[model samples]
Structures are given as structure tokens and as C-alpha cells.
Target chain A: MSQSDYDYLCDFLKERSGLALAPDKEYLVDNRLLPVARRHGRKTVAELIQMLKGPDSGHLKVEVTEAMMNNESYFFRDRVPFDRLGDTVLPDLLRTRALRKKIRIWCAAASTGQEPYSIAMQLDQRAELGGWRVEIAATDISGDAIERAKAGLYSQFEVQRGLPIQMLMQHFEEVAGQWRIVERLRNRVDFQTINLLTDFSRLGQFDVVFLRNVLIYFDRDTKLDVLARVRESLAPDGYLLLGAAETMVGLGDLFKMVPETRALYRPNVAPKKPELALVPGGARVA
Target chain B: MKRCLIIDDSSVIRKVARRIFEGFGFTISEAADGRQALDACVTEMPEAILLDWNMPVMDGYEFLRALRAMPGGDRPKVVFCTTENDLAHIARAMHAGADEYIMKPFDKEIVEAKLQEVGLI
Candidate 1:
């Protein structure tokens, strides 16, 4: 690929998906776009870039953007957050939302549904959540990913990654030599194709939002913009989970880190005093 | 050192699992079948056990039951590593007191993840 075409793709991806491709990442562009070029009957990535620059490249642009976007995912990708979901996060939400008897969770960049499905399985294990309405809204920028996630099917290799065998046996059934997540768990998640760069207010307020691992691609401004929008879509007491390496530093005052937690944050509101519990004939304790 | 017993009929799998677990600082021991594994356990109980389902002398389920019945046997974190992918086999393994399970043809990453899940690494 030529310098000019590389520059064009870098800018295009940045504008469309908030993917800040560095100048030195021309090799990444070639590696990802070459298969797209072949699929489009183009001789080389240069030809694909030329077509991408054409007047009627609207659909082609979407394809290119998605091809460049990383879709890496696995069951319970990071174990800590899931553990926290059961031990602390969900327990807190259960107490806070007991009267409402409803909990909404958004997997903002739910590549192929593992994160959301993992969350669903975790929620199922919580006996206290019985009779409560739970909605897991999982969305990805790639329609292909959303469709695959909706199918709930996975390869042998995919199922083995970070998935506990008990959960796999309990939740997924073998279908045509591949593992398919059971219909009950599949129906728990509502998958959709959504771009984080665009407005997602239609997703409504969520008690918890998992915006993990996808923010590393964005520049400073895009991160700030997306974080602000996420803050808007979250409930006042809702929690936002970011990637292990990602943070809210220098992104302005949209969120504050939840005390004694990593990569977990709540809205940037004034701290609420802890509720003290009192026992009969005993002193109050926090 | 954190001791782990690798029980598999296949020497290749045992070697591979040894290499991976060794890198994670586990002192590894090998056993060919479930009977041998149970005897090894009676001598000195390991902190963790990587068990295989279909062995010639004694299968994983029988061995698991025997081990759990023995004193200090329930202390080891038993992880079943086998080719058996069906629900019945998996459910039985868990029911027999196996802490975790892994499908066969596991690589370093999968082993690492499973070990991490069981808190070995």
C-alpha cells in the first residue's frame, strides 16, 4: 500500500470507529485489508483503497472499518471482573435495586457475546436474583459479530478459552460439531449492531455497563466523547467497567473509581456515606 | 514447591502438561493410570491433580471416588483433563468432586487459564 492510501485508511478508521491507527501501522492495514481486497475481487490492498476513495464507497467503507476493528474475545476474558460481579458488584446492585426488581447490563463492545453470556451465567448463579427482570443488552460495531453472537455458537477452540468446563457443560450444547450456548441463556441477551462513536441513548439507562478493552483504540478526544456519552446512558449509581489498562485519567470528570476496586467506577457524584447496620442490644457497624 | 500430579495414559500429554506446569513453578509428578495415581496419592497427597478420564487400570471417576474417600484426598484441587466433551461425562466429573475440567488437545494458554481458574498459578 502507498503512503497516501495508508494515510487515507488511518483517517477513515479514526473518523468511523474511533480507531487511532498510528502511522507505523501500515503493516496492520495491509494484513487486515488484503483479505477484504480478495473478497471484493480487487488485485491488491491498493485497489481496495482506491475503491474506498470512490464516490459510492459507503458500503465499502463500513466493511473496511469493521475489518480493521479488532474483534478478539473469549469466555470470561478476565476472571477478576467476573468474580467481582458475583462477590461484590451484583450483591451491591441487588441491595440497591431490590425494590425495582430489575437490572439492566450493557456490554458496549460485546464482540461475539462471550462477555454478555458470561455475565448471564453469573447472574443465573445468583439465587437472590430470582423473580427479578434482567436484561443484558450486548452490542458491537460489526454486524457480523452481532449475528455470530446471536447464534451463540462457538468452535472447540473458542469454547476452551477462559471458560470453566462446568459452565460450558451447563450452558452450551453441541450442535453440528460446534458448541452452541443454550437457548435459555441466548434469549437472556439482546444482541444488536451499534457503533460507540454514534449516539446510544436509545439503549436507555443501564445499572452496569461493560466498556472493557475497546477504548484503547481511541484518541484522547474520542475517549472523552465516548466516556461522556456512556456516563449519560448509565444510571446515577451505575457502574462502568473499563479494560485493565484503560483508565479515566485525563478524560475529565465523567466517572470516579469505586473504592477498593480496579477498573470499576461509578458516576462522578458526591460520595455517599456508608449505611450503618445496627443489631438489637448492639452497637452500629458499617 | 506447589506439587501437581499429571495422570494420563499418554506420555506425550503428561510431558506437555509437565512442561507448562513447571513453567508456572509446579513440582510435577507423572502417573500412567488411575490406580497408580491413587497409590501415588496415598504415599503423598499433591496440592493439585491433573486427571484423565479413560485409563486402562482404573477410570477417572472410580479413582476420584476412591481418592475422596481417603483421608487428605479432598485437599487436592482435582482438574479433569480428558477427550470426553459430552455433558454426562463433565457432570459426572464435577459430581465426583473434581474442581475443574479441561478438554483434550489443550495448549499452554488453555492450561494456564484453567490453572489460573483453579488458583494454581
Candidate 2:
């Protein structure tokens, strides 16, 4: 592909999806878009780009953008975030949401559903959550990924990655040669196709938002924009988990890190003043 | 170094496992069947055992049971490796004290991930 075509594709993806592909990623564009080109009977990626620029090419644009999305994810990925959910987040929510008896979690960029399923299994196993209504709203930028996540089917290789045997036995049933998430567990997660660059206010407020490992791919401006939007979607006490390598430094004070945890943050709430308490001997303690 | 015993009747599987485990910095040992694996455990218990199902003389399930019955057998994390994908086989292995199981035709990534799941790596 020529420089002009590559630049056009980059601009197109950036404008639509907030995916800022670098100049060095021309080869990556060619690699990801080649299958799309072949599927549409176009000889080369350049020709596919030409068709993208033409009139009445909306579906082709969707296909091309979906193909370019990075959907790499696995069960209980990185482990620590899930551990924090069980040890810290859930317990806190159980107390804070006791009156409501309802909790909502959003896994922004939940690729192929592993993260949400992991969370569902964690919630299901907790007998304490009995009679409480829990909803995991999992969304990804790619419709193809959302469909696969909805099916809850996984290959042998996919199931093996970071999934414990006990959880596997409890939550998944062997289907033909592959494994599938049990329907009850699968039903807990509501999957949707959502682009971060678009309006997601309709997703409503979430108690815990997992936008992990997705921001590193975007440019600086897009990162700030996405974080700002995510901040709006989060509840006051809601937790936000990012990739281990991602941070909120210079992205604004929309979030503050939870001490001693990796990539775990909570919406920035001002510290409350300590109230004075009367002591037995008439001494006041603050 | 972390120790791992690779038990399989097939020399090919053993060799592949050795290369993969060695890459993960494991001191590797080999066994042909369940009986051999039990004997090796008695001699020197490894931190991890990668046992194949349907081996000659003794299968993985038998070895797991026998190993768990031994004095220091419960110390090692046992992972059953096999072509059996059915829930029955998996349930049997887990019932016999196997920490995890992986299907056949696995690669280094699968082995590494399974080992990680069992806290072996």
C-alpha cells in the first residue's frame, strides 16, 4: 500500500474508533486488513482502502474496523485484579449496596468475555451474594467479539489459559471438542458492541469498571478523553482497574489509586474531616 | 531450581515436556508409567508432577491415588496430561487429587498456563 492509502486508513480508524495507529504500523494495517480484502474479493489492501473511500461502503468500513481491533484476552488475566475484586471490592460493595441489594459492573473492552465470565464465576461462588441481583455489562468495540462472548464457547487452548481446573469443572461444560460456559453463568453477563469514541452514557452508572489494557493503544488526547468519559460513567465509590502498565498520571485527578494495589483506582472523593469525640475524663479526641 | 517429573509412556511427549519445563527453569525427571512415577516420588519427591493418562502398566489416575497415599506424596502438585476431554475423566482425575489437567496436543503456552494455574511455576 502507498503512503497516501496507509495514511487514509490510519485517519479513518482514528476518526471512527479512537485507535491512533502510528506511522510504523502500516505493515500491521496490511496484515489485519488483508483477510478483509480477500473476503470482499479485493486483490490488495490498497484496493480495499479505495472501496472504503467510495460511496455506499458503510458495511465494508465496519468490517475493516472490526478486523483491526485487538481482542486478545483470557480468563482471570493478570490474576491480581480478580483477587482484589474478591478480597476488597466485593466485600466493600456488599456493605455499601446492602440497602439496594443490587450491583452493576461494566467491563469496558471485555474481549471475547473471559474477564466478565471470570467475574461472574467469582460472584456466583460467593454464597454471601445469594438473593442479590448482579449484572455484568460487558462491552467491546468489535461486534464479532461480542457475538463470540455471547456464545460463551471456547477452544481447548483458550480454556487452558489462566483458567483453574476447579472453576472449569464448575462453570464450563464440554461441548463437542470445545468447552462452553454454563448458560446460567453466561446469562449473568450482558454483552454489547460499543466503541469508546462514541456515546456510552446509555450504559448508565457502574460500581466497578474494568477498562484494562485498552488505553495504552490510544493517543494522549484520546486517552484523556476516554478517561474523562469513563469517570462520568463511574459511581462515586466505584473502582476502576487498568492494565498493570497503565496509570492516571497526567490524565487528571478523575481517579485516585487504591494504596498497595496495582492498577486499581477509585473515583477521586475528597477526604472527610474527622469529627471530635468526647473522652471519659472530659478530654476531646479528634 | 524447581523440580518437575514428566511421566509418559511416549518418548515424544516426555521430550517435548522436558524442553518446555526446562525453559521454565525446572530440574526435569522422566517416568514411563504410574508405577514408575510412584517409585520416583518415593526416592525423591518433585515439586510438580506432569502425569499422562492411559500409560502402559499404570495410568495417571492410579498413580495419583497411589502417590497421594504415600507419606510425602501430597507435597507435590500433580497435573494430569491426557487426550481425554470428557467431564467424567476430568472429574475422576480431580477426585484422585490431581491439581489440574490439560488436553493432548498442547504447546508450551498451554503447559505454562496450566502449571501457573496449579501454582507450579
Best by DockQ: 2
- What is residue A207's positional error in candidate 1, in angstroms? 1.8
Pick the TM-score winner. 2
Q: Which residue runs does candidate 2 get wrong by more than 4 Å? A: A270-286
Ten residues in sequence with the least summed lDDT for candidate 2 chain A? A277-286
Pairs that collide, model 1: none
TM-score, chain A, per candidate? Answer: 0.93, 0.92
Model 1 Cα lDDT, one tens digit per residue, A1-286: 8888888877778777878898898788889999999999998999999999899998998899889988989999877778767777898998999999999999999998999999999898888999999999999999999999999999878898899887888899989768999999999999999988787888999999999998888876677667777887999999999887778776666689887878898898853333332311121222
User: Where does model 1 sit among the CAPRI classes?
Assistant: medium
Off by over 4 Å in 1: A270-286
Candidate 2 docking: what grade? high
Residues A1-286 of candidate 2 have per-residue lDDT tens digits of: 9999988988888777877788898778878999999999998999999999999999998999889989889999998899999998999999999999899999999989999999999898999999999999999989999999999999999998888888999999989889999999998999999888777889999999999998987776677667767877999999999987888876767688999998999987753323332222221222
